[model samples]
Target chain A: MRDPFRSICDDDLERRWIWISLILAFAMGGLLGLYAVASNIHPPSNVETIDSSRLHLTEEFAEDKLGVKQNDDGSLTVTMVAARYGFFPPVIEVPSNTPVKFRIASADVLHGVHVPFTNATAMIVPGYISEINTSFPTAGKYSFLCNEYCGLGHDSMWSRLIVVPESTQGK
Target chain B: MNYSKAASLGLANMWVAFTFFAFAALLGLYQVIERIDLIPALKSPEMYFGSVSTHGVLMGFVLTTFFVAGFGYYTATTSLKQDVWNRPLAWFGFLLSLSGVLMAAVPLLTGNASVLYTFYPPLMAHPAFYIGATLLVVGSWAWCLEMVMMLATWKKANPGETVPLAMYGTTTNAILWFITSLGVTSELLFQLIPWSLGLIDTVDVGLARTLFSWTLHAIVYFWLIPAYIVLYTLVPRAAGGMIFSDHMGRVAFIMLLVFSVPIGFHHLYMDPFHAAGWKFLHMTGTFMVAVPTLLTGFTIIASLEVAGRLRGGKGLFGWIGALPWNNPLVLAAGLALLMLTFGGFGGMINASYAMNTMVHNTQWVTGHFHLIFAGTTVIMYFAAAYYLWPKMTGNALYSTRLALTQLWLWFIGMLVLTLPWHQLGLAGQPRRISSTPYDEELVQSWLPAEFAMIAGGVILFTSALMLVFILLKTHGNSQSVENPEVEYAESLHSTQRMPHLMNSFGFWVALIVVYMVASYGYPILQFFLLDTYGTVPWSI
Candidate 1:
């Protein structure tokens, strides 16, 4: 009997499958690339590191300077610290219809912050800063949730994000 | 060669794996109910997180590592037509790994290691937990050595003859594991163990996480490869046909090995440490691993297509219907492939850098993994056990009917449970929460999904118990088979004279080393160069 194992079309079929699969995979990659580059929005990947132990002593994340402050560039910078059980500057008050840039860092361990039903999310790893930029279109009350499992009180690790009207910023 | 020695060893390892699996499954059921906060008596955060940690460890590490090593031993011996290269070492490895499991279990079961299976530090576990985990991986290294040595010995004796695909896969996995495990073992040895033991006062969190990401993603592929091996080598024959493409299977296995190791930075996409360039690099590499999965899907379906047509089915869709559904292995492939389809879709979303934000660290991540690991991967583990039990035990299975029923329940349980979790994740439910005591409206909205998950959990627990019962009954089964050792499906074509690149490992290993250095070199090195602060361990 001829070696039936020496059959045709097995490699041929597989070669074609490889091409098709590769094409399919790259197409998805291309689409995601286009969305990332074209839309210019993505998960925060800024590589800024800060000594978390000295976060309160730092100029950028100083305890006195925490929470939303108007930048010289006419944008809002919300500097918050993610400690074990809660976010620092516990309830943030930001003006809606303005660009808000968050500079979050973990004071202890690791934590993640996510604004529900929005693309505003980041993992706050210790020894680094989480810088995410977003804008709230309308005045509303939202929450900054600790999404990562930090410690025992992670269940209650949430604070209010009260987005008030731009005119009511001082209030 | 006394193959029964390999069989007995495999059986012993498998029983230990199932014991952990059953306990973990019960924890899984408790977790679903606990998170719902329905029964006030079950509302303890410490208990909940401890259960979650133990559940993840038992299911993810203890069950998979034990089962894969056991199955590999069986495959190595039978496919190579040789006894294990060092039987005493194999037994020694088994005992060491088991001891590690027990040692780790002490901390995990007692709420001291509620860090979850990810073991994110400076969230400290008991020193024993880290030590035990290290010992477990180290023990598995012994099996890896045995696998490589046995295959090398066989090749030397055979001289340019094709390596059997099953043995090829087992060896590839062994080598893949040796490479894959280096990252975690380093993390354990250099950082976690020392920090937990008070040898080191603090740890660089960014550096620790970067080291972990190296092992995190590939470890999933480690759990998954044994299932793929069974699919490529055994399922087609059980369904009444040969492998549609044996050569493709080898290439697929190689791709899984090479691509899986370097792409783990995708897990760190949402984190603050890595910059955009490196994350983007890992994301693309992550997408590259998907190709092998697609290839495996095509090859297996094609093989089944042949089997169905050989059994007198016709047309594009008719063959699916004609498959030997009564056969447990065949039924499993059908269900496993179906789950893989959905799980693969979820994986693509996770791989895409932009889309990963939507599901990252949410219940969707949890759901996606359970579907792949529990739904696609573990189901196949069940089928492999069912298929191999009679051959290993010298007795026919007590009830094939019960086995079939068990599989369906597992499938149903996974879908019903995980589908709602995706919904909850989208609605902004974070993973690893002990309870949903959040905004009343938000908590209320998640109620229906939580209830559905509890139902799913009950069904899954029922299915798990059924699996354990069946295995136990099979051992005591009276009807014995004449030939306990059975040969399985052949590939459509011989792999002799395939390109040396396809068969060899040296080239692949070197390529992955270059790839890993390129992907991770700067990201990890920055910790030393930059003013990164280390932290002392934190108590929960």
Candidate 2:
């Protein structure tokens, strides 16, 4: 009698295909990881405060302010304020390709500082400053958003980093 | 009081619910495709938000509520083997729910109610939306009443005979939902409805959220119990094996009922108004619920093993291959279990107090739920439909082959859709958005995954079309076919009587009440008592 259950034992090729597919998937994942590592870009080398464009966010940013502001003669100044579950001073205009320092912190809850255009994002914890030393490479409108589920007014929380062309500034 | 009429009425309600579910699913596919940026024509923020909000409401609220109520009614009538006590009231419940859905859809379709599926206030929806949702919940409460009363009636009638396992689980959910939904129901009725209607000045957002949280977590278990019911009562039998332990099923149900409620704090881990101590306590309960799930897994696997071995499998795990693959229920159960394991793992990460921050509102949250609710629970629902269609219609299924293919496609499609979604979440993509308008880098990173998701949606759409076609064809078939009566598996070690607690809900209810009070009482009170400034210390 031809056994009905024989297919289970005999289907070695089918099992092998499953294994092969899984392996291929892992291989593709590894390749993607390698590509990410190879093409990695760094944040602006050294900046005290950086601000440049108006950005619209899908959710609110919990950061009290977008970025930091430094002084002219050589004094580094950081202003930290409180905002209610959203980003304040949403648009900050700064000179293009200039190094500026920013000390960013959340007043209410945990908020994610996401600069989608620049591939820069960080978690802004309440009462903790997340310092990112980066210069906006281009004069364009860039946006930051809170990627966290902060509160009811989450969607309205947005900030823009406006990078002005260097020649236009102090005109 | 009529059994046949109640069955007909309840089954019709389920059919309506499934129809809504199917509609939601099609919209879901469209939304997924739109998210992928594959269809340029389908990329409107208004339309996307509308479709998404409608889809969420239809699937999460409309589908689950109607199905649970209908199934509850059906089970109450059958397992009790008595007529439903109030036929008109049941129909009234149905009409109220149906009307509520229609009312809510007006805003959803117009995109006026794109506050997303969750009506977390301050970002307000139309008054009709809140009123409609409230009506839907209120209608379902009647069904809950019927369930408790029926169980009480059965106890009165039968005196000492143990309530059947099916009836036992149904009653547990009925009781749980009644106690559970009150928090949200009150929030909608008192706060949201009045506020949305301009009847109230400055709504208390914190209080409203707190109330919503109370219902939020328990409602998941409410949606889940029907799937578990099928698992315990139907799957074993479909697989040609007996349930491993009747006591185990009861223990699981009891555990779910008692433990599922207080764990809502996990959702509030990052929210204000709730204290750390409370969140920690709820986290413990959340983890404790895992015990029952593991128990269910063990019992279910063991049951399947018994069936597989009996079919002449030789080795310890070789029994796996011996199980039937063609039977819709068995196949669906197998697939559902696989999805459950992965979804449950994601759930554990989300429920974990520390790790939850990694993927709190990200696509990971969406992916996890889609896997569990759509992948695990909905697949079983399909299996149940397949098993019940013949009985309901008194005719044969249109095509077993098509049904089997649909099941496979659904499972495959879910994996295709959600796996990429989880990856995107890890790579930092937020859920509930129209498009990646700016953020070129994020959009570029998300595009490939989004494209993959579109393919998944297409597969799922094709699968859904097959389901609709098969069901319709089955309904249109002329001659009545004589199919065998559905059979539940007999236990390997059959006994004459079940354990007292296994057959009784009284002890479980008392335990749940105590657990809830011990867990939630102090936590909720602290919110009102704590003196906080602009920001509450207990942030989500």
Candidate 3:
């Protein structure tokens, strides 16, 4: 009588096929990881934290510097706040074809920043700052929405990213 | 072996599980319709969120728990050829869990606990909700203990014999649940309960989320292992073939237990509570866990191929056509593997550190989970029930044709429901929302998909009703029938001389503890160590 619980591990042909499948699967995974890293399409690594309750009173997130700003190094920095109902600076303007660093945090609860058409996304949690670096290649309107469920108003929590052409400087 | 007591207990638990499943399916249809804004009367965001929360808990917690317990009872009794070690204690567990479900249902239905299933603070639910959820977890722990004790007692009696594969798989899941559940147990007992009762002024949302992440991803496996067990133990025999590899089955089960628990930080990839380094570490673990699933797929397919070949299959792929497709268990397994392929790909994308940004928290995530959980896992549950119901009740199935129809409807409905959800996620539609009145142009593109989903939900709801009707009719029917018994798959080679590591779990349990500590210790401790800010509780 044959054992019903036996395996094909002992069969040479089947063993070879199993090895091939395992290797192919892992290789595919490896390639995807490599592409993500080489393309700079990954989660941000800049670790920064802040006091969530006092975000509005801070220097960087004060009423003046809460949106997009042209930095001294010819790069753009966009600072945004995610609250209960919507994102602060419901619309932001950045120059296309230039690197843009987004500095984001949640004022109340946990939210996520997802620019649907692009690879610029990160979590917005209270007491911690999330930063992502990416640049828009084309001048267009892109909508960034809260991906995490916050409350009843989570659906209404969205903002617009208007990437103007680099030729439209200081307009 | 007289299994009357065990069969009755199993029947009772499964009946409760199916009832909750039917209720949840109705709520699921209503949700899809409401999201499309088709009916004005069902358009309340308050009611919608309440229904969503209840739907999630009923399906995620109630149905899976009760069904797994019932399945475990039947598996233990049949596989080991012994009565359940502690019958009275099993009943106690069932009653306790049922009471917990009732306690939680009040707040969940009345909109007092509309925090969604995650129940992250500071969106607190009523204290009763937290207490009820706690009781439910505790009751499940009783089943865990019973499984482990049964295995231990059996091993002691038969000193050198290998434990049965079904019993081994059940015990593995039992240990995994005990460990996987501790995270949520701590969160409920310490943070949510205190804040909900006004005993605490503020709750640390960061800590709450961190702890929840510990349980979130692993709990999916707790729901899914039984499905996998059925695939390995029953599907092959049902198809008239032996399992291709019993050792591989043990290997897969062990890998699942070891790798699944420590990889949960991937759920927090978009959350701010954990550092990128920790998230990346967990991402690697998440990718590693996919190996066992891949192995299981290979083993099951190989088993089927062998079965087909034995049935006069010819050529390279002729085996596929030769195997039985009409049997519900075999058909469901085939459909399940199909869904697993697509769902597994989606999971890899979500688990990737960089690619996660593309679909994070979008309807893509929702679609991915539904494909895996509802499509792959629950379908197997239905197959297992269909296969087991007749045996447990000592009656013929009401209608094999209806069962087959129900299975096909579920598979088609799932594809219809989830495929568009993936597209909507790419189109910028956010999930967990009552309405998507965002950009009107973007929202317009999603309208077709939403309508299709409602149609799919209706099909699924009808299928759910049919399933319950068949089970009830089968139970009540008076037609005399042969007393059928469970027939587990056999292996081509003897498993009497298996390696010690494959035969025991003592080392695996110790390894899991060390791995969890290494992965989660610092991430959770930083909240207490640092002066993390807290938020006031906000209840509905």
Candidate 4:
């Protein structure tokens, strides 16, 4: 009986193409994984937690300590709180060519910090502190925003990241 | 017991599915218009979110569940050459789901449950919404049980026979959905319902997100499987060719079942509750799931290539032009693969641990999902409906020309819609927002893409209405014409017998259980073991 649905057997060339495509796909995946690890471009591991309901009362997230500060170790630490409609310290200034650690936490629900055109991004959960290390190579103004859907204000939930020249680092 | 009865059962379910689909499509158009600030009347935030939530649930949960259940019944009856095991029980499931939909619709339409389908807590909805959603899921479990039992009964009666490819795929999806849904079910029963009812003052947001992530990603697979089924079993025959390999199709289904469930944590890559280590593990599994999709692409394309070659086409790629472009199924499969290739690349970026940070929660994520779900999967659903409508109704289609035109319009509209979404995401636009009036400068840059998206939405909405019109016309057509029975593709090499592992789900099910436990065990346990704080529920 003739079956209309049956097809001709795959030729050697077609089989070769299939294997090549599969291998290339897997290899690309492996390479991407390797680059992520080797470059240390991943979600930060400076694991810490805070009481969400009492964030304002905490010393670490006190209004006085909410902007860029020069740490004792000569590195800069930017501490900010992501809240209902905006990020605390809505505008931050950082020195170009200097490694900075962004210590961000959410005051209420889940939020995400995503800086466009750079790999400086992390989730800001209410209780957890997300810390990512990065350096801006060029001096320019960049905007970062809360990417996760928080509430009605999610679309306008944004902050500015102002990177200054390295020569004026202290300013 | 007869063919007509089985067809009627499937047709009834599909009718409900298409109705929800039409409603959701209209809501989608309104959402785009609202976001663009094109209409003052549609500018209310409460109503915008309500429409968004309803659109997501209707398209994601209601339409997919009903359509898959209906398609599964039809495939099982026709392929196995047996009536559904319990016909009345199946109808009961249908009615139960429809009632659940109506219950959910009340709060959704009233703007009380505008938590936008993800329903991630701290933000809570009405108690009735949770109860209604629970009922819908429970009703679907009935369909799952029916599919599994039907396959088992068929196997017992036809001992030593391999399950037909179509039936085998339907059964695999049934098992996949059963396991995939447990996460959401646990979340609803233990947390959301209690919190919504004011029984629990506080809910652990971390734990809630963790449970949801379990169901979040794998559910996409549940939606895609029916499309894959149509591609493997029906498209080949419709194209006048066989499945490239029966064994390969089974391998793809099994791989999807095993790999899809354990990788749900990929959705949580941006969520802080899960450690980065667990996220990495899930990312690896996500990459593994891509293998089955690749295998599927090769098999289906190879089948099409053979069909084209057999039609007297010459040269290396000349066979493509020789195949039946007039056939809706063939055209849909071809377009679906094209969308899958582009969408699959975006998915890879989302799966990568570091890269996800760039696009997570952005409009890029929205673009990726719409391409896969609305473009690849829903297009096939349309094709399958077009193919089966004639068989089910015992009448000729109202217009093949209209059907083909609608398919092309859907493809073009989807590309036009989603490509700009990816661009807007890169331009720093966040999703699930009613408007983007933030910085004049930044919002200005997004204007062109937003306009393009509005145009795309108009095309899609028009195409959606056209589809409903065609189906309605075909069902109501008075023209009497001969109707052909549904025909599934044969395999290139027929199998009289197969190994137990390939033929049966026993081993696979056991293996999947082990894998899921390993992947999800510790991450979930830490929430309870550690002193985790819960925030008081806040409702709209």
Strongest candidate by lDDT: 1
Over 4 Å off, model 2: A1-86, A89-144, A148-171, B1-3, B494-497, B530-540
Identify the superior model by DockQ, candidate 3 or candidate 4: 3
Judged by DockQ cut-offs, is candidate 2 incorrect, acceptable, medium or high? incorrect
C-alpha displacement of B175 in model 4, angstroms?
0.4
Instruction: Give the poorly placed runs of model 1, Cα more than 4 Å off.
Output: A1-11, A165-171
**Chain B TM-score of every predicted model:** 0.99, 0.94, 0.99, 0.99
Per-model DockQ = 0.62, 0.06, 0.45, 0.37
Write the residue-wise lDDT of candidate 1 on B1-540 in tens digits. Answer: 567899988998899999999999999999998998899998999999999999988998899999998999998888889888999999999999999999999998889999988998889999999989988999899899999999899989988888888988898899888888899899999999989988889999888889888889999999999999999999999899999888888888989989999988889888887888788888888888999999999999999998999998898799889988988898888899999999889889889898777788889988999999999999999999998888889899879899999999999999999999988998889998988767887878888998999999999999999999999999889999666775667887766667676666889989999998998888889889987789889987
lDDT of 3 by residue, B1-540 (tens): 677788898899999999999999999998998886778787788888999999999999999999999999998989998888898899999999999999999999989898888996777788889999999999998899999999988989888898888998999999999999999999998999988888887777778878888888888988989999999999999999999888788888998899899988888776656767787678777877887898889889989998999989999999999999989999999999999999998998898877787787889999999999999999999999989988888888888899999999999999999999999988877778888767778888899999889888999999999999989988986874465789999987688787778878999999999999999999888887876777777654
The TM-score obtained by model 2 is 0.79
Per-residue alpha-carbon lDDT of candidate 1 for residues A1-171, written as tens digits (9 for 90 to 100): 443323323565676778788989888878877877898866798888888888878988888988888878789889899997899988988888889899998888899988877778899998889999888877887777899999888999998888888887674
A12 Cα displacement, candidate 2 (Å): 35
Off by over 4 Å in 3: A1-8, A21-25, A32-41, A45-47
lDDT of each: 0.88, 0.70, 0.86, 0.85
Model 4 TM-score, 2 decimals = 0.96
TM-score for candidate 1: 0.97
* Model 3 CA RMSD to the hidden true structure, in angstroms: 2.8
Q: Fraction of native Cα contacts kept in each candidate?
A: 0.73, 0.04, 0.41, 0.33
> What residue pairs clash in candidate 1, if any at all?
none
DockQ, model 4, C-alpha based: 0.37
lDDT per residue, candidate 2, A69-92, as tens digits? Answer: 456843233333224455666667
Instruction: Place model 3 in a CAPRI quality band.
Output: acceptable
Q: TM-score for every candidate vs. truth?
A: 0.97, 0.79, 0.96, 0.96
